[model samples]
Target: MMESIVDSMLAQETPAPAGNPIESAEELSSIAFGFMASKALFAGLHVDLFTLLADGPKTAEELAKAAGIPLNRIVTLTTALASVGVVSISDRKLIQNSSAAQNFLAKQSKYDFGDYLRYQIDQQMYPFLLQLNAVMKGDLSDDAIASYQHWMADEEQASVYSESQHAGSLGPGRTLARKVDLAKASTLLDVGGGTGAMTISLCNEYPDLHATIIDFPNVAEIGWRFVSEAGLVDRVRYIPGNAVQAQWPGRQDAILMSYLMSGVPGEAVADLLRKAFDALAPGGKLMVHDFMVEEDRRGPALAALWQLQHMAFTPDAHSLSVGWLTEAGRKIGFAVDDVDNLIPAMTKLVVFAKPS
Candidate 1:
């Protein structure tokens, strides 16, 4: 009887929902005030609160003394940190709540990513988001908001940006190396490969794979240092110039363009794709890993937010859709192979291949 009932239910076709369900006013408000939580986390990271608590629990007074901040401010900050679950307050002392805080937040940890949050997200992108309204309205002049080229021209800013991105990219880079098959490929072209994080990760994974990283001179210099530090200087080389304009070093079996498309104008993407296609040997693979929106572009809230953030700085920055990319690849004589979300609902990897 149970088997029959289950079969009957399975035989019935259910209609799909019409559209996204409307969010509650309170939920909408929470989304709007999300910056408060971000700011709190940033503040905690900025003061190295997690690192201070790494030894053990500490009283607000002790934290204030160690961090050289006022006791009152530390108290308030600890309370906010507690609310965010990064720290816990027990017996009037604060303790690091999770291993994430200990591993990623602490300065002493080998996998520390605190600098990424501090420099890229907090110092750079946070301020850029504030200008979204002006940017959308076209009130902000091009010179007023610095493009990636302009920003990277400043060596100090480029170093900070590159280092921060390199730190943040490590985990994702390892994941990419594991997920993608590079065993058959001999040469890879890592376009706009900042600090050689991804290249280093890939080379570490594949013993026979050699990679050439192409980026601006300032970023390329930093990448060379990182590659050298990783002892991958022999396999991974840096080419200092624009990925789109500069002469591609040689024909590659695989090419990776990560987090580069969203920083450029939409019209320029096709040209870049064409360039990648032309630079690849027959049957070569091209991997584009970046944030992508759904066909409808309604809300995968993170991607939408990132798109808005990019718009604030870049003149034509917008989240590309997978369908568009597949179509674009088809037009460029490449076969679209797969589109998979590397970071569930956030970053996507769209893979294409040149026909042999």
Candidate 2:
């Protein structure tokens, strides 16, 4: 009876027109299996495989012995990694990290963000993605990522998330500091500033500048530790509260909202922009950095993917665009001053200014 039911369903399927037949299904197949590649990369990070290869090349047997895994298991892992160009195996059967892996995945490199990849992206977000369908269909509540307060309720988990996120954010923070001119602005507010990474970067760039970060209490605690480490205790401070509802200090010289928009529900975005406009001094700049798709929303796969990923957590998440922000800012009595890519195609920086 089950076989007949299945056959009936299969018989209802239609074939594509011969003229419109696909040249190849390679692209579709690649995307379908993309998760497997990501898992391989995560597995490599979990095993500290990249770090081990950092010291020098090693044979499979040597790696297995060093990592305390069986030889067959190590070989399988290395083969998967090698296929993805993250690592390479030589004719001599010695393995080493690719240059990109050596730079960013190895623990020894100054630019290494291995913790970010291993902890935040892999362990945290990866598992959360499984519940994405539920989130989209509005079937799930008690979301860990969408509701920031709920997620930060646990101090230990918050520390792990923030610390890894800080590692990922610092480099981009420095990039923003260099790209945007905050030289003349002495006061800045970093709203939803995770771990004060952006503030630290800006303060380091401008010695005269002082930054106040508004975030959840647990998040602020972690930010304070990072600020102390950066020796910007005097110049950098935190206000513990929800950024959307908290009373913001008026007449700020500049405001930064990095990775803030897409994380919040769609309706709150306009309010956030309004808040920034209200908070800024005359001619003050508000920089919004987040995953913004192209105005036409055609390509730039990474940006689109990130926005979609955020929707999995944030049930009412808005899909952002340059046009959307410009329209929203204009309605709030602000002029769009500048727009640029902050992280290549993955994120954008849109600067809006209140009239002086």
Candidate 3:
């Protein structure tokens, strides 16, 4: 019965053309088995297989010796990794298939995001997603899974969460910096700014700009460290508190909320938008960078998946739409100036401006 419901839901959510039954079945199978690929990637990261192959190609015996695993297991894992294009085999040696692995998967690289892949995606989110069926059935209580706030309240958890998310945020942060015009703005407020990734990126782009990051105390501590490491400690400061209830420092020329709104209850978004409007200076701008579905709430597969995953943990959190945000901003007396895709179809940037 549950299987039938789930299949019905998928058919409605991602319907294929009327005559393309084979394509539909293939796509459905791919979606159902996505966990296999995810686990393969996670296994590679767990054993530092990518890092081991960073130097050059390695024979199965060499990989086994380096990774401290059995040769048979190494061969099996490498075959899976090779199938995924992360690694390749040439003349009985395994090689990292793409430069991306060397630059972003190897531990020694500055752009390495292995921790994010391991901790955030594999360890945390993967298990959380097992509850999706229960979540959709409304069988899980709010406390069934810890709220993000409660999860981050523990200093250790907060540290891990902040650090992992920071790595993933860098590229999007850099992209945001390039797209937005902050030249005339002196002060920016980053609401729920975890570890200051976007803040640091923005400050790097606009030397004269200073940023204040508002987030929980533990995350703020981690953010401070990141700011200090960036040598922008003087320009970026932490305001440690719950952004939703805390008193925002007023007179800000710009505000940023990246990947924040979707974590909070949907009912709170309007209030938060109102606060941003009130806190901004007369001509200030407010930016929301997040995962948004199309106005009809159909599939951009990644965004839709993320929305469902968020719903499993966050009671009222769901993927919102750009049209919804534009309407909300209009009610608060701010005009929607621009909307752009920050990361192709997955993430979006919507800019709203206070009337001059």
Per-residue lDDT of 193-257 in model 1, one digit per residue for the tens?
A: 88888888899999999999999999999888889899987898888887767888557999999
Cα lDDT tens digits, model 2, 102-210, are 8778888766777877888887778778878888677786734457667777788789899998877776787788778888899999999979988898899999999
Query: Model 3: clashing residue pairs?
Result: none
Give the distance in Å from residue 289's predicted Cα in candidate 1 to where it truly belongs: 0.4
**How high is the lDDT of residue 175 in model 1?**
71
Q: After superposition, how far is residue 204 of candidate 1 from its true place, in Å?
A: 1.1
Lowest-scoring 10 consecutive residues by lDDT in candidate 2? Answer: 1-10
Error of 1 at 200 (Å): 0.8
Rank order (by lDDT, best first): 2, 3, 1
Error of 2 at 225 (Å): 0.8
Error of 3 at 183 (Å): 1.1
Q: How many residue pairs clash per model?
A: 0, 0, 0
Q: Write candidate 3's Cα lDDT for 277-320 as tens digits.
A: 99999989999998888886665656767877787788678578
Provide the TM-score for each candidate, comma-separated: 0.90, 0.91, 0.90
